[model samples]
Target: MNTPSPARWRPNRYQIVTISLALAIALAFSVFAFQDFRQGQLAFRVFNDEIEVLTTLANIQRHQALMFAQTLAWLDDPAAGKTEIEKQRTFLASQLRVLRPLVANEPEIEQRINNLQAALQEYDRLVESLGESPSPQARATARPQLIELLRRVDEALVKRAYDAQERSFVLDFGNLLRNQERARALLFGVSIAFILLVLFASGLYLRSERNTFNLRQRQIQELQAAVNDRTRALELAAGVSQRIAAIREQSQIVVEVVEQLKQTFNYYHAHIYLFDENRENLLMVGGTGEVGKTLLERGHKIPRGRGLVGRAAETSQPVLVPDTVADPAWLPNPLLPETRAEVAVPIVVGNRVLGVLDVQNNQVGSLSELDVLLISTVADQVGIALENIRSNQVVERLLQEYQQLIETSPAAIGILDAQTGVFVQANPQMLEMFELTPADVGQVGPIMLSPERQPDGRLSQEAAIEHITLALQQGKNTFEWVHHTRSGREFRAEIHLTPAPNREGRPMLNAIITDITARYEAEQQARRRAERETALNRLTQAIQGALSVEEALQITARELGQVLGRKPVLAALQSTLLSYDKEDQ
Candidate 1:
């Protein structure tokens, strides 16, 4: 085996090419590394731009919120605030212009910009149509659109800032980029000198390197295999963690994860399979090359525990087949006949298996446990990326939906000062409940908003304070109280109170007032009906027990009067004659 062959000594295209292009490859790698340094430099620049973007966005949102305040101001004196509103709108537009270029690269943010513009236009039209003096209802309906404008501006900027912080790796490498600058010139000179020296030395060493090539071929190959496997795995793993972290779509993530695995490792095929709604099968969601396309088109899938991919997903672990031909569990596909080695790694998040990442090579014994671990690492990152995207989307959706719910809910909602129980702000339903305007909120006290006495003989102010105190102490409280509108209309309300976000160094409560007047009246009618039945039974028993007619008559009158809540009229045999006094129970 140690003896050298004449054929081995003969110059091959590989060695010749390696010999010829070694210097170029080295220089290119160096230059590429420099480009990476330049990339880090550029990242810093972009980060600075983002900070400015945040500032600009904040100003725009501030103007939007201020415009809302101005609308409230307009309610006070419409004629005086028109020019100021126009001026604020102009400033908002100018700030938006400044923001456009900064986020031009982001289509999502750009779309938000478009929405913000449309909302601004709608707001303008609505405000203009109010026509000098609008009804309280119209003005109330129109005031909150400005908040939507604020949300449009604030939501994107906040998300962008968070994403910017997360995606910016240059912060850690910023110091390293500076160090790279000093070495660049020296590297270029050494590289040139080394290239010239290598040509001369390589010519002499060709004979020696060739003679020893046969002796070292086995060792070189083994080392190269191990090195290549580690390198590809590390690169793929790093790419999953860094390069694709900014990708917000799970579909894109799955595709990129598998495609990069196939490309970087020179695998014959690579694919990602995700669980369907029922999770009984692994469906090919993403893959590489023509085989991947064919499989996806054919709607390829493997049932749980049926194949390597399925087994990986089912167990939430990896399955490796170094030689698929010898493996009894390997699933053969005619489209991927070149698969001689295979590996499948589960894409798991917590206890849930989302999918499997599968890759195959054409050469037998090409895949190994190291490949399994590396692929599994990539799979885990894929899981995290997908989960993060889902969580973020959920949170944003909930936030938007919550605002819409608060804006449009029919239940009377009001924000109150926890200490005094005075409404600081109220929704339309709350305003309608009290027949009060926005301006009346601060002026009205708990007792003024409600009747002086509760149905339970408790002071309205005292009961309100108790409820507010309980909510502040225990996070939430629910109770019933009687309230009177400004028009002296009394209605029964069931108030649910919860602690709200603190404002101005004081606690607050969100009061959800449900009108229970109808329900209360229905229950009271039912109670009276039951009481009348009980009293009739008792009166019958009393009449049966009475020995004298006069005693029976007196007992009948007393029972009738008690039941009717008034004096009973004496009738010979008809005991139904009764009258009710308006002022008496």
Candidate 2:
């Protein structure tokens, strides 16, 4: 004899707790798997670095052994031997210089490299000391030093090999494969466990809900026409969710939302009110019926804290009114005189209230808290969809603006691959500054654009890598660099480098270059001018101590020639026979 309720639609508490616990356990496993994956990657990278260092160092030693043997064979023909050995020494020294940046993090390896380099220079000096056609004794004398150099190479290489092998054993590339397998096992286990948990929860939910669902179904079938209409509206509303994700138009979204609500719930009228640009007032965006159209045409608006819609927006909560005629909070409109019940749900995104969705009915007590909950669900979907469109639009606009800025910038800009040390992108200014075209610079190495050595006596390739590592590891770096054009014109540049990730999330180096050749030349000229003045003053004082005028004049002329650097300065005695006049005078 008692009418059944709408099945008290809500989830079971015990099922929610069980599912939440299972999800928490899965999340914890996922985090551990991610950490193991990262550790494996680090081990693999370290293995590659160890191999590179070992291989490069081994090549250097082999090259040295070959040079020494070849030079010994050509010893009888000293001219041939000297020329070949000098070329070989130059190459071998470059290899040693390159090792500095490679073993930069290993002090022990760097020290060994330094020792090898010093021994190589000594060998060069001993070879040079042997004349073009040396006697047997001279060759014999230089032979011991050559043997000593070979011994040093052997020691350095052996020590380096031993150290690298030890480190490789600790962190091998094999660990990467093992970690990957473990990650797969963990993922499979978690997936199986979660599936079983879902199945158990679903069974319990279905069994508990069956009787309640049947009771509500029997009680709700009185109005067949209303049921068919509401069912049709719900189908249209289902499509709205998919459309909301893909569609970008704001007005079209809200219009469809309001129409669906009015048709689906048997409401007399429905409309959506969104905050204006300043957010001080809520402007009606979309509404149903002729009365709704007139109000929209006249620009219907509600200020904050004024009406039921404003109250919902301000509080970020739903407002429901049954029998609006008895509630002073409901501001009745003459156009909606039959509206006895009303509800408004605030559309919220994050913590900010963007708008309100309002619905009115013709019968008192027709709208309830259940209707407020229904409208809130729709409002939440709209908020999520609008936010997605806004984010995508903002990101696209920012990308375009950044691309334009990089293209038009006056300073020479370059982007280098962090892993390969290659020039990947060069702006027009960068190409012009290097006297290279796009084709000439693409995929080229930093060493290819630099001279053999810098003005400061460091190898250009080594210095370039040092500065690049500093930027990539320490966030940023600024330094002076020496580069050369294809035609062999060397120039100085001030390089500013910053680290940023590429589209693939790999680290990349961004550079801004300014030509500092003119400034550098100016500084050199000032330094030489100061040196010349100092020499001139010293000569003047020395001349005052000379015993004879002619002697004093001779010393002054000779010193002037030396200080002025190869320019002739003559002091010719005049007929008066007391003083020497300048040659030009």
Candidate 3:
């Protein structure tokens, strides 16, 4: 009555023959497709090459026109235009050279390019001759000839060459289109034949598949399950990566990672234990739930290799215990008394293991190889986050030290945004020197600290920006600046602006300003003293060399008058009263 399960429906020879025919047709179609693709690619390459050649020729033509303009510009202002003319001439020559190679395949184009080069050389000779002319009259005479030569080159050489290349490109493009159409037709026929063969083969295949449909369906289901599990693992890794990356604190990263793992994977308990400085003990640093809090409060510690966490940390490897109760090394914690299975993955950075990420479940054998793999991946992310946090902490410490140093420094120091020319930070000494408050820090620009005009007669704002720009370009600048304070008191400042590395990795200007007014005044005093000494020496010499008392008095009076910037009257009591007033005499 069962009818032998519908004769078992075994495949016959017809199905095999149909499958062979289908495969052959498919192979033929594939070959046709490959040929068609290759033909299309060749057509594209040909079109691109043509376009490149046309573009090069066009660029050369444009440069030639620019060269002509520059030549005319030279006629207007020879001194300024000569340099630009020479540069344009050099560029045009280089373009000609580039075009020469591109058009080498076409004899007409190549000949045209050669003629163009010859014309360019003649033009350059004329320009050079014009430059060497002794007077503008001779240059004026040569201008007509230069213009004629430019017109001839532009029309005969560049224009003709472009037309030739364009015609060649059109012909090549037409041929390529025709070849592509032929390939497409052949591909279409082969594809149609392939589709019909495939349909016939599929009919046979469907008849054969009905007998083993249940078995194939089960296999598909298993494969889909595996795919879903892999997808889920990837999604979890992505989520954990994002969460940990945002956390820059080592302890916080650990805590967030553990909590995510427990919630995402529905593990009974999750804990993170970090290695102590001595690398001898694993201390619970972060965990999930009240159980985690209790363990953390108890300051639970385990020596290396003492339990799952310790083993993972010590070996820098993952450890899974399917049945903690059956494992000899399993150390049951009072907080997680119901834990039946445990997995530990090391949180490692480079060659060193920083900690272990442990997950526990209440069901025995609940953790599989996939669970271990996923948790281990998350542990790696946690390790990277820890490394980043440690690096940030180190940078923060260094920054604090630097800020303290700047604050205590005697020289006035300020940090200015290089782009905006605005002050971002100022030290105490800087604030006092500028007579500025902390509130004025960000509101001020480099010019605000300078007088209306500099000692050199340059506008202070313009000069400051110029020097700051120079510092940014060259990395440092040191100059004497006249700065006006809030009280309208002008003083000399020796400013050293250096490019400082900022937190955002951008270049900022560090202005180290030192008041040099007193030093300048002292220099002036020393000069004046030297001048006074010289004047006294000259007066003494003149008096000593005088012939008589009156002469000496006259000499002394004249010398004293010169030194004092006024006439002096010298009187002497002798046999007859001797007197000399240098201005009156």
Candidate 4:
């Protein structure tokens, strides 16, 4: 494979000079073409101005000659009115003066003006000659001769002047228009050529740009391929290292593995967590680097089907979160702050999952295949360790419960030697009632009780011991006694003693003492109340069966009031059923 050249290559000095020369030539050609076009347009404008002036002069000259002809014709008629002659003269003079100034610069127009003035003078002379003839015959003969002379000169001068002006306009103004049209055509052709040249240059520039773009694209593709290969190699190497190191049992050690791997490959933040019993959540257990404590303190958790972590757990696969915002599976983790990329690997052991391991960064697409493989390998080890810890905890809990159940029993049970009354074991309550702690309760010495209980109408220590010995010897199972505690509180208890025979047939007493203090007090109170209830029942029966109200009152007062030492007031009941009595009576 051919390696790409470094990015430092720039246009060489010769190339720069060549490009500059090309631009300068193009600019010079454009400037020259523009100047040519502007000069041609200026020439056409000058020609057009001259043509307008010439056309206007021609119209003026024509109008003047027509007016002069009318004036001479009117003067020739002997019977022509003075009013009509004077009107023709005034109109002719106005046209001559107007035409004269308009074409004053042209020699042909100047000549035309002088001829018009000469014709006007000839007409005036003819008019004055006709007026001088006194006889009508003389006037008639003189008028025809003068009229013919003036008309010939006026017609010759006006027609010749008009002919000269028309020729001058056709020769000068028409030639100017033809030259202007030819100049515009040549300018238009030059402009078209310049536009074609610009288009050609632009096509060349675009082709060069396309070629450059294609070349750059190919270079970029090659560079990317090489980079990907190198990245894969680095990833594999780092993965091997991580796999070896991350197999530690400790969660902190696994995190250290992530840190070392990150250092080897240069990554951002790294974290790992294992699931609790329920795989519905991810608890952050360990992390590496600067934000490790922050993540740990935040206690970030991912619920099942909640975020990227949850998705990975649910699928039991690895997940790569490319964008934190766009991915619906991604939830904001303040600990991973501004993190745009993340990877989560399931820590699976056997068929069960321990937790998830995560690597995160503020850059998108940070994790690779190597990260996935390495973290998964470490996860197996973590899962085993977690399982072991949980199993041990379960066993310990069971043992505690068993011990607690033995202590919490209400029966005061003790173990004793068959031949001797030596105490071997006692429950906590049993010891407490005897005013002794566990330390002082069980001993190999003789069994003892309060000396005062014998005289106080409670069971004597000697008698209780005899009873226990007889129960062991005869296999009697149970007996009852009124015993006094060390605190002077009396208790009625039933002692159930059994002979726990050993292999030699020598038996130890297993005595179970159940405190019946509350039951005994309740029995005594019941006996006293029963006697009062019986007396009240008899009195109520007497009152209910009494036929008269006075008899009922007397019986109630004598039986109830005398016994209770309280006055009884009798009120007549509305009915026998309404009276307070035993049963329905």
Candidate 5:
């Protein structure tokens, strides 16, 4: 009876179970409260992001309006407003690009963005048309359409932005209500368990604080890493850009670009696949490593839309494969067996896709969005460089062909400075005809090619200057002149002077010379022959009408002497000549 009365203050099993249940409920409520807080934080972050997107869209619309106003002003006064309009247009395009990523997940917004893009394109076309011919008719036809398209785009953006704002407000309000309910439940549970769980609550609070500190540290580290990666990407981009800028040849540019990409970015491999003349296949133009050499030897080609590189070129967009083996669009090459990731960016200039820049890595998810952006920029630069190189090559080839033709021409041609009347260039025929070398003719004035006096009784110096001036003013002149060679030999030449366009965009004189020395000699010989014939006829007629042979002989001698410009001796025939001939017979 005394032992039974000893445990009077001890609680029963049901009471202990009730207390345990309350503690459990309190702990569960605390966990739910933390989850709710986390969810609230996430919701707030999402709401803030949505607000930013809406703000950006609003800014884009404002910029579009500004651009429209500028365009109208430009249409009104093209010369005064063109620069401002272009500036506004460029700003609007940049803003639209900024807005593109923000609304990419919203279908309706994306559709509206697409429409805006199309409208902007149409506006650009109309603006270009107006610029080309700033006629009232063209403006009347294009301005209304442009204004309508701009208004539609503006309305679409504004509506989408308003809709997004409304959705964000609804989500925020719902999240707030849910958080308030969760907080009430958490407070009730905590009140029920506080009397029994002070020590437990203290321990849990300490653990949460430690976790928060750890999370903060981890976030700091991640932020630092991101900053470092961004800096590294920027440095790599700048270095590659500088290197690409220094290169002049297309093949050299491709090779340097691929090599830089591989070495700087530490990519597993880098390759450039350019479109062939037919544009049906992408041929490997430049690459790095032994796999590249093997591919080059094998003449590796990717058809349009066949693989990542091909797809990028076909679509003129970038293609990224985080895991090549898992991506259906990726085509594995035996030469690059270790490749786990790959990205192909189209090298485009304006509307032309010159090639595809393909880079790969040995690790999955090695490439980031930053990498894509940097590489895309590099691709654009490479495309521009390749276009410039091709254009320069074409110009050089044409210039070489023109120089060859000039050197091989049969006519004696020389180029003279229009301003100074000095010889700038001479063909081989011209140099040979003048018996002068290039060094001797260099910087020599046109008067150097002629004697002191010309056939037209003008001083050669004054005449050459006058002829150059006339050719420069009238575009062409042709006249015959007497000229002297380097060896002091004078010749009659037909000089043709024509104005020609030079490399400096200024006019130069092209002088073509024709020698008429042989023709002049032939004409003189024919005139002398005619005069001799006339003199002989006159002598014959005088002899026929003469009374005596002496008169006829005298007339004949005088005529022959006059024609020959010298004295002529005549011999008389005697009767003794016939007697000697008869005796011999």
Candidate 6:
């Protein structure tokens, strides 16, 4: 035999497809990951730019406020106004010197700043003119002109500020679009390259058909293991991603609906304040966490317009308090323990502030501008949800009160499904009268009160249920029955049953059982004794009237005394008188 021609085998369809597809997919993923990394970098840059813009805005607002305050102070100075006004001029020039360089390359911005400077000069002239007047009356004459100049300066400042704001918006929008486009292009290019690589791999797998049987077997096993591993990894990743997405969605919804946003501030406590449903008072809704629960139990209240949160609600403006510890506008919270930073945004719908959303941080500068923006987005969802939750609670509370009233009423009240012979409800009194506890009320059937059948030939438990069902269907009122307890005590009950309406508008039966066994027995005993007494009295009277006094007395004494256990006239009468006398005394 010519050394048996080495087994020549072609690649199986599954092996070729799986290997080629896996290789292509891996390559595609690598490319996609690179693109993703680049996109992440671009997003990070955009975020940084946003932060820078916010910082600039903060600085501008601070500087402008300070400048306005100084200008007002200078207008009040007689000497400074009459003379060179050296300090004021120097300050203005210094501010401009710094501002000028910032916009030097941007002609439009520079020109705008220069215009504001010219307006400020006009404002100074008007202030100086008022200062030169000799008397209050003369100064009053220039007051209108001074007011006009100040107004002009304000208008110019506001215009430039708004312009800068507009420019920032435009730049942000443009950069965002550019970043997205670039990421998309890179992703597309990589995807195409990955597809071509897969095609090449497939061709190679087909051409290299000769199989070393053992090696092929080993490769197949390895491939199967890799596929299993990849599948498991993908499943885990998908599960994690879904969970994260759900959390985000729920958080967003909660933030929108809740008023006076209840949030956990720390491990130990949470703070809840009232938010206006219609710009009224802050309302406390729900809170958890250890510290949060304590704060709510302590009855923390945020009066409208009292604190940062209240102010936001009252003014219908978002308030970001940088340092809660230092800001007087932040009402002190005993539970807060010097909260370092806080932001409150009004949750408004169509100009009506529904509630205030507040977020707190323990460390200074812990909350960034992005946090405030994100919180605001969440607040929009929270506002409606909060309102719905509150309304639901109110309705639920009212229903509970109604139920309580029914449960405690003197009437033995109970609800049952007549058809099923199931107890839907039972009052305390009803349960007690039946020797039942709350735990037993819902579980036991109506016929459970009857004796159960024992294995030792006692009454069958099933028989008692049949009796109860028959009685219920008959709608019998005032049916006398005796219940033999597990302790063998027989309790006679007079039960009354009536048709009860079910919650679903179905007919049900309510049976009221009254224990009348004692009463019935007592009444029977009294009637029997009364009949015996009547017979004896008649016999005694007949004997006294028909016979002589001596004989009649003797006979009456003997027969009546035997029955009554007493003498009629002397001894008994004396005893009765003495007893009455003693009782009277």
lDDT of each candidate versus the true structure: 0.72, 0.71, 0.75, 0.59, 0.73, 0.55
In angstroms, give how far residue 369 of model 6 lies from its true place: 7.4
Show the colliding residue pairs in model 1. Answer: none
Stretches of candidate 6 above 4 Å error? 1-95, 128-138, 202-369, 372-585
State which candidate, 1 or 6, has the greater lDDT.
1
Per residue, candidate 5 scores C-alpha lDDT tens digits across 340-427 of: 9999999875446888999999999998788797898688668757765664554455446546766887888887777766678888
CA RMSD, predictions in order: 22.5, 26.6, 22.3, 58.6, 21.9, 32.1
Q: Could you tell which candidate, 3 or 6, scores higher by lDDT?
A: 3
Model 2: CA > 4 A from native: 1-270, 278-280, 287-300, 303-306, 314-317, 325-340, 348-352, 360-367, 370-401, 420-426, 435-448, 456-461, 486-489, 541-585
- Residue 272, model 5: Cα distance from true site in angstroms: 1.0
lDDT of 1: 0.72
Alpha-carbon lDDT of model 2: 0.71
Q: Could you arrange the candidates by lDDT from highest to lowest?
A: 3, 5, 1, 2, 4, 6
Q: What is the TM-score of each candidate against the true structure?
A: 0.41, 0.47, 0.57, 0.27, 0.49, 0.31
Q: Against the true structure, whose TM-score is highest? A: 3
Residues 1-585 of candidate 4: C-alpha lDDT, one tens digit per residue? 999988996888876765676576557657865775686577567546444444434333333333333433343344554555556456557656655765677686577568667766766665665563244433423333343334444355555655566566546645544654554455445444444444455777656645654565466466556546655754555465445433434655556656764666566767676666665677877777667767778786667766777777777898877666778767776656768778887766433566677767677766667556556645544554455344334434533543454478665666566565656667776776666666764453224543445534765666767776787566455766666665656667777776542324444665567777788889989998998999889998898999976578677767776567543333322233256454545
Candidate 5, residue 117: how far the Cα is off, in Å: 27
User: Model 3: number of clashes?
Assistant: 0
TM-score of 6: 0.31
For residue 119, give model 4's deviation from the true position in Å: 99
Candidate 5 backbone collisions, by pair: none
Better of 5 and 6 by TM-score: 5
TM-score of 4: 0.27
